[model samples]
Target: MALKDEKVTLAHGGGGKAMRDLIEEVFTSVFRPDGMEDQARLQAAALADPGARLAFTTDGFVVDPLEFPGGDIGTLAVCGTVNDLAVGGARPLWLSAGFIIEEGLDLALLRRVVASMAAEAEKAGVRIVTGDTKVVGRGMADKLFITTSGIGVIPPGRDLQAANIRPGDVAIVNGVLGDHGAAIMAARGEMALSAEIASDCQGLGHLMEAVLAVAPGLRAARDATRGGVAAVLNEMAAAAGVAIEIDEAALPLRAEVRGLCEILGLDPLYLANEGTLVLFVPEHEVAAALAAMRATEAGQGAVAIGRVVPGEAGRVSMRSAFGGLRIVDMLVGEQLPRIC
Candidate 1:
């Protein structure tokens, strides 16, 4: 193809000379700045020891209407990766981005998303050192998809996991719940009443840093993403072979989100969240943990919502607003399947 008449072809996904040509010509050349490629390898080589334990995680992004009211796919992808590292008690250092672009996606739009991702990386003090790209036939794939892989190093003398949970532990949330899911529904014109609900898609590392600084012995922390706070709690209960009792009255629910959930017949407890976290702390240290969380942007709405109990493991029960009790279960199929 001539310089002025280039077209994407199936060869782009082959990982061969033609594939490299497409990636070099269409992707890196368009989105990356100088010295951007292969930074992961370069940084990994410089680690204190190449054999050190590394925290690795990967996720795929395919939210519809990529650009939403509060955020787009690029920002969510970056925040998701960083939040995972943060909650795992690791210092995020590097990332690898993989893109699958539909054949006819606007080059300018792709550029904008890539730039937003770069900005997020800079904010989190992480670098996108390596990546791959493939373009499919226009009708064969969605507009664009992003898969981000992150690597971080855990600090010494601090350990956290589901198995650490036990009876007499308190459960806390970083902030009010269900905002992100509500925002996405509103942005998509699925909600009847329109308020300026925004997706809380932000990196929670800074907030986690604040809490860990004060309580290095923090038991367990998880971002309330797809399955929300309710789903995460159930997972923890099962993992630790314990049961959890949550006070519905104590669960923070913004009036707007709550109202929408009721109208739509949706349970806010199992809704989605992008920037919120559910953490388990020792009963005695709940106050300090809540205080530290409230001090950070990601956790200003933090609150103690429940406690751990021993009984039937893997189950979560909630006190109703009417003083009744009910079960909170995992999302059956998909609440927002590709909203990640």
Candidate 2:
């Protein structure tokens, strides 16, 4: 039998009876998945559906403190994987989780993390189909690290890619940025000041569905995670060999976040966000897309922030409020490591 009140130990990862007991009592109990096979098998008929394409993505999470404002590592892992598929215009379906844990960690903490993952999976309408777990010596591994992989289905003709970006295309963001990064920084207690920021960690599958239903011609979409919107915009420009110009006056930023960034000498554009998305659509379809995004609770703060333009290839520039221009560059090194 699994030890209900004891801490995790190396034996739990020995692939013996202790491992089986732990798996059944913790992960299996919470997930209660329909099947428990060596590999998940999908019916051929499902894959043969007309216009269906599969999207697969994986992410790793090692946020310090395990838990934070608005979310924990568990929530981060599931949402990060789901957003990766959503941005590709895919409907998330199944997920696999892997855990690397430090021995002597509290069993209650593991239960909490697994339960959080299950909750997020349900919210995104995805199932945790399979997973593996390992336990290492206390100092050899962090408290807990999780990696999640997901598969999603893309409908016919819903091809979205940076290569499709065109001049005059509109740039829009679903909501505010830098909340997740700011929250994590504050949670670490490394800085002296505090703010009312909370990590914007949540699933974006439903929001993506709403937008796609209204504006099927969306050229491309990217989740501004690591390196924030700056990185994504730079990549889009480089990939499409076009120039992107954003307006400083139109950026969606919270007052607390702005103040926090200034105080810390960090650029909000370089900070990370979990629940935000950057979208590209032809100018003609911008209105329809904005309307659709605003209809969802997660997208109520949507706004058009800029436009694609013709300039030096692979360049991103921002028009300042004072009518000046500044280049938005990629981050050189890690601003906040283990942030995801």
Candidate 3:
């Protein structure tokens, strides 16, 4: 209620009382950072460990519809940054958000987005300590775009990387694939298709922690975001200098997602996912890893989808349900743009 305008204007971005009111009422009020300084002065006990390492990552989020079925751009921004750090075996701690908001955007919508960001950060155990906002002319930008940078700590002696994967490693996914993409596509309503799919948008820091607790030898994990599971699998194979073979029957997918892809003539493997991730763990520890993952809310659908093997390096193949093999290559181009 502090902001008097129903829609944002260029004055809101100017360094004046309007801008200050917007920032204080819309953003900082919800984030509640320790101070209003231009930069966040961060300190954490985990960083005090002599052998611990710092992990930093930044990502930008833009989707056709700012709000979606399961999540809006705000939820996507936080979860995406948190998952980026979590997949690298980091304990996410802090984040910075930057907003490029268009004039005429509803003030209520901006408030909702800020609230969503704060809630997700709390759930992911991180703080939004600093942020910047700019309002542009109506046609100069979309309704809103968010860029998030995250900071995390890697415990001493924990070095998870794709190159650490070995031939005997097994691949596991956190949950069903293609739901996010399918949900977005259906939400667009361009094809007259209807289905009850929601974006699996969620933070994976807790799930990663749970798995690492039980399977210390876990190799690496990648969130199937822009390019989906096939993209992650190919990257893992190429980085580890090994071949990956996934069983078609083992891929966890919903029947609605399958039907959507079939109707659109799209391959499900190329579909994007927000909460799904593929990880590699030693064959000996697959059971433990899957159990640990399933115990977490973000990983209940965890399953072994594939295994590493000795073959032509950087090659990935899929075994069909009928017992036939086909190469799964890097996606030549995007199947859906602006998916993340």
Best by lDDT: 3
Q: Candidate 1's error at 80, in angstroms? A: 1.0
The sequence of per-residue lDDT tens digits that candidate 1 reaches over residues 1-340 is 3122144456656667777765665556544534644554445442575444678999999887788877889989999999898888787888888988787676556757877887888888787778878778879888889999999887665577888987999999988898888888887775466867888888888888888887766898999899888889988888899989999999888898999888878888878888999998888888888898888787889899999876688889998889887888887876665677
> Over 4 Å off in model 3, which ranges?
none
> Candidate 1: which pairs clash?
39-129
**Candidate 1: Cα lDDT at 181:** 83
Residue-by-residue lDDT tens digits, candidate 2, 1-340 = 4565478989999989888888998899998866778777654344578979999999899998788898999999999999999999888989999999899989888899899999999999999988989999979988999999999988778898999999999999999999999999988888776686889998899989988888878999999999999999999989988999999999999999999999889999999999999999998888998998999877999999999998998999999999999999999997787788
Cα lDDT computed for each candidate against the true fold: 0.81, 0.90, 0.93
Candidate 2 residues lying further than 4 Å off, grouped into runs, are 44-46
Worst 10 residues of 2 by lDDT: 38-47
**Cα RMSD for predicted model 2:** 1.4
Ranking by lDDT: 3, 2, 1
Positional deviation of residue 126's Cα in model 1 after best superposition, in angstroms: 1.0
Native-to-model Cα distance after best TM-score fit, residue 307 in candidate 3, in Å: 0.2
Our tally of clashes for model 3 stands at: 0
